[model samples]
Target: MKNYDKYTREYFTPPVSSLKWTQKEYITAPPTWCSVDLRDGNQALVVPMNLQEKLEYFQLLLQIGFKEIEVGFPAASETEFAFLRTLIEQDLIPEDVTIQVLTQSREHIIRKTFEALQGVNKAIVHLYNSTSVAQREQVFRKSKAEIIDIAISGAELVKTCAAQTDGNFQFQYSPESFTGTEVEFALEICNRVLDVWQPTAQNKVIINLPATVSLSMPHIYASQIEYMSEHLNYRDHVILSLHPHNDRGTGVADAELGMLAGGQRVEGTLFGNGERTGNVDVITLALNLFSHGVNPHLHLENIPEIMSEYERLTRMKVSKRHPYAGELVFTAFSGSHQDAIAKGMKWREEGNGPHWSVPYLLIDPKDIGREYEGDIIRINSQSGKGGIGYVLEQNFGIDLPGEMREAVGYRVKGVSDRLHKELIPDEIYEIFIEEYVNITAPLELINYCFTHRDDYEATVSVRMGEELKEFTGVGNGRLDAISNALRTNLGMDYTNLVYKEHALEIGSESQAVTYIGITASEGTVYWGCGIDNDVMTSSVKALFSVVNKLHHSTSTQRLVNNR
Candidate 1:
């Protein structure tokens, strides 16, 4: 706080701009994505990736459908140069892919970069120079004219090297600190390089404007990109690209807005890994577009595999809360959130057509290889009846009645609260079975014979502990008559019996599951479940289980109140 006076806004604002990119609501299409993981991202690592690691990462980039990849700065290191040679000599570079290498505005490095590209089919000789005001004054000690001359000289040398090299080459130029440089100066230097390359309809040039260090809000950068796109030389022949770093945690925002401002390509890393905060996350950016019903043109169907490989090779961990890719991004733990998500999923299941409007979920988890039961409705102390019931119905095919769900929900929450952890689907099912399914305790139904006539009658044999007793009661329905037999034999009393049944298909064939709930005299409700191959037997077991639960709970509550 004491040094707050020393820092102020250091970013340069471009001349008054009438911005049009704001009118667009979203990115209409995918941009040409170039992964800089091998270069920009690798350099930022504490222990940079080795040759084999780089090779593995290169294959991953290809698998993700990156057309252009900045493999490395060959002139900077022997390993970088060797990686390029290995890819070229081993025929690893795909015919459709183009490898790009970086260099500064020097002659020998430029020559060495070309040497690394020898015998390659296609390559992009990326030439860049620090053109920021700070770099010109402090680092280079050069004037504006001198800086422009540096870029121009690099452009000419790249052109010469491409002609002499034994490989096909394209040209790319970057104002390294475009965000910190004056907008007009950035344009002027890029145009000077364009004038040298003379890009045509058949052969296009890339003009990359990097937010080497984020200096302002994203819209300001978008405006800068728009100004350059509108006034750049040979606009049709130039591919305006954006390389945003996440120093401000808005790299994705900058890339999206920049595309709207006429940029056609993005250069970033897998999970935004780079120097300070890292580069823009190409995965997040592409998937954001995918969520809006636009195909990102990249294969990100299996994100878990991608994240695993990325972390293994890079020694970096993707956060559990990262957008669209994190483990917990789609998971709901709050009771209300889980309830809504469960209801929304049910609505989708019951609907007649395809629509992805699930509440609290922007995209379907299944699209990215995530399971709905495990990943969506997670169970914890905060989970509710709807989510818990949904988990059972979806994974285990046991549907609880409305009031039974509430009772079971509280029981599950109590267990989770005492254990201080979240419960998995198996654990939840085990709790359900242990607590409510076919419980035979103070009372157990031994046998039942029913007679259906104008009025229903039944002779039921039940066990009260070690003793067996028979009771005959008559009622309008078979189940009601059975209830009447229990009351006549054991003096049982309850009301408002409710039940639900469904076929249990998971790990079972021809299995039926039934749930029952009953209200005792004190307005306390108890729930139970029974699973069997016969629906009638399952229903009888469910009724007996609920009766036992009610008797045990009432006795326990009475004992505790007396104490």
Candidate 2:
């Protein structure tokens, strides 16, 4: 903390004041997305991908709907050169997709880059040279004039190669490390390149402003983009692009605000895989629009398959907390969060609205190859009764009473806490059954005969410990009649019987589930559940369960007091 004085704001602000981009709420449309996973992302890996691996990743980018993908720097290595040749010779390049390759200002590398482009249908020859202040004095050891000459020479060479080459080609130039360059100087170099390419409506140029090393907050980057958007030559014929890296962990924010400042395209890798912190994540950017009710023009519905192929090909593990594509992004482990999510999902289900407005979730998990049963409301020591009850109703179709859910939640949480692990759906169901369903110990239901003469008279035979006892009572309903019979004949001091029933709607079994709650003499409530094919039988079993639960609680209290 004492070294704080060493860090200063090295970023330059745009010349224009009161930027208009700050007034925008959100991006109304998605930008043209270009994936550099095969180039920028591959080079950063501990081990570069092989030929077959590169091919597999290329196909994945195509499947993900990338119209422009930077395949690799063909002239940098033999494998990269060979990968381009394979794509061209094998006719693997789709007609609609245009592959881009990176190169520098040197002549031999430019020539060899064009050689790899032979027989290709369409491609972008991307030429770049660092123009930052540090690069000029330290890395490149060149003056401002020399840097401009490097970019202009590369621009002219790219034009000459496009004319001689056998394939269709376009031009793109990036002032690499543009964020570290003065705004006016960055514009000057880019305008000189535009002069050589002479981009038209049909043949547009892409001037990518890469945050090669992010140095400041996103607002500063947004201001830089706005300055470029306003002052750049051939503005109508140029597709302003942004390639933001996450050095400061604000790449996504930078891209969003940059787009609002008039950027028309994005260049990033999936899951933000690249140099340093990584490239801005295209998946996160695209789905952010999807969550805002705008189509991102990318097929991200099957995210699991995309993630699987990405990890397999790149050998880079996607973080479990990665936005939109992580394993646990939609999962809620906090009790309050789970409860709100549960209620929100139920509201959506009952209304069946067109828009997604779930409380904790920005978008529906089901829309992206995720499920609510296990993925959304996960049970743990921190889980609450609402979530536990939602799991039962949503997965197994057993809706527990409100008070009963509290009791069952505590029991489930106790088990999870002691074991120090999360409980799965089947395990939670098993716990529910073991703790509260059809529990008969001190009092067991033998049989019941109900005669509806005046109201409803019921004669029930029950086993109390080792004795078989018969009880008779009258009430309006069969459940009430059984409760009356138990209290009157067995001297059980309980009242205010409450119950609810519903038909099981999930899975293969056809049965009815009933919940019963009763208040004992000490004003303590006991709850139980019964599942059976017949509703009447399930109700009787439910009442018996509550009686046994009440007796067990009293006995436990008595033992504790004696101790």
Candidate 3:
């Protein structure tokens, strides 16, 4: 907070007001995306990618549907020039895609840049010079007229070099550090360059407005773009492009608003990898359009694969919290969020709507090669009954009853809390099995038979703490008869027996699962589950499980009270 007065606003507002971009609600279409990963991104790396790595990365960009990619500054180094030659010599460049190379306004760099494209089918000769006031006063130490001469001479040389070269060429010019340059001077310099090129519809030239150093809010950049778009000499024949840096962490915003203000193309790197804070993240920009129902015109169906390849080739780790592609972006750990997501998934499963409207999710994970099980309802100390129950049902096909899920939730959360870790689906399933399913302590069924008289009659042989016995009782139903037999024979007291059964569709089609709930005298409900080939056997086992749970819980409570 100290010495804050040293910092001052460096960006310039246009001489005239241009507020027409404010009326647009959203970007209706995706911009012309040109990836600079091999150029700008590689230059920022600690160890630049080798020829092989660049080749693989170029193929990846092609797969991601980039029609234009800036390969590198050919005159920068031998490696840069060789990489371009490799792509052209090996015929690695696709016919529909164009490779671009950056060069300074100097004649030799322009000649070598064109030399790298000797046999290329199609290419863009990108020319740029620093035009910001800081570069003029401190770096170049030249007047505005001298800077304009540099751009014009470079444009003339590039046009001359392309004519003598053996490839179809397009021209793109950028006033580097355009953000810190005076808007009027920026306009004048761009118009002067256009006068020489005289671009037409069939041969449109790109006039790139770069926020080489982002210094203001996004609206200011948008208004600047609007001024350029409206006042450019060859407005219809020029492709207005934006290349925003993320020094202020708003490169994506600048690009979006600039597009809304009549910019037609974007030049950025994937994952925002470039100098300083990095270029605008083309992935974020494209996916933002996608979330708004516009096709980003890129194949992003498998973000995980793209991230893996990007990391492997570039040696850069995509953060786990990165938007849309991050590992934890779709994971919900909060109890309330988990509950809503679980319910939303169920709602979606029931054919509620044709569109994806799930709670706590901006887009469906499955649409981006992510699964719902581990990626969605991850269980920790903060998990809720709905999320835990949803995990059980989705992973193991064990749907807990509505009344029973809260009880199971507490038990699971207690284990996770004590262990200080998240429980995987298998671990959660094991906990369910050990704590509630077919428990056979204090009361166990050895054998049983049922008969239907006017009332159903049942007889059972059971074990209780190393003792075996037999009992008989008659009730309105078979399960009720078994309950009556146990209560009478064991002198146990309970009421309000609840039972439900369903076929076990996951592990075995022939097996059936049954759930039972019984209210103790102290007004606490104990729950249990059983699985067997026969529905009747499962139901009887479920009843016994509930009785065992009740006995153990009471025993533990009494021990605690006595202590």
What's the lDDT of the predicted structure labeled candidate 2? 0.89
lDDT of 3 by residue, 1-563 (tens): 99999999999999999999999999998999999999999999988999999999999999999999999999999999999999999999989999999999998888878888898999988899999999999999999999999999999988888889999999999999999999999999999999989999999999999999999999999999999999999899999999999999999999999999999999999899998999999998998898889999998988877876787678786776788877678888898999999999999999999888999898888877876555455687666687798889888788788898999999998999899888999999999999988888888889999899799899999998888989998899888999999888776788998878898888788988899999999899989899899998899889999999888888899899999
Q: Which residue pairs overlap in candidate 2's backbone?
A: none
Candidate 3, residue 143: the lDDT equals 100
Candidate 3 runs further than 4 Å off: 375-563
Model 1, 1-563: lDDT tens digits are 79999977777766867389999988889999999999999999999999999999999999989999999999999999999999999999999999999999899999999999999999988999999988888999999999999999999999998998899888999999999899989988999899999999889999999999998899999999999999999999999999999999999999999999999999999999999999999999999999999999998998877886887788787786898877678888899999999999989899835768999999998897776556455677766677798888788877777777788888898898899888998999999999988888888878898898888898888888888888898889887888888867767778888878888888797999988888888788878788889888888888888888888877888899999
Question: lDDT tens string, model 2, 262-324?
Answer: 999999999999988999999999999998888999889888778867876777877767888
Lowest lDDT block of 10, candidate 2: 371-380
Query: Alpha carbon lDDT of residue 148, candidate 3?
Result: 99
Each model's lDDT? 0.89, 0.89, 0.91
Which has the greatest lDDT? Answer: 3
Winner of 2 and 3 under lDDT = 3
Which pairs of residues clash in candidate 3, taking residues 3 or more apart in a chain or in different chains?
A: none
How do all models score by TM-score? 0.68, 0.68, 0.68
Clashes of 1: 0
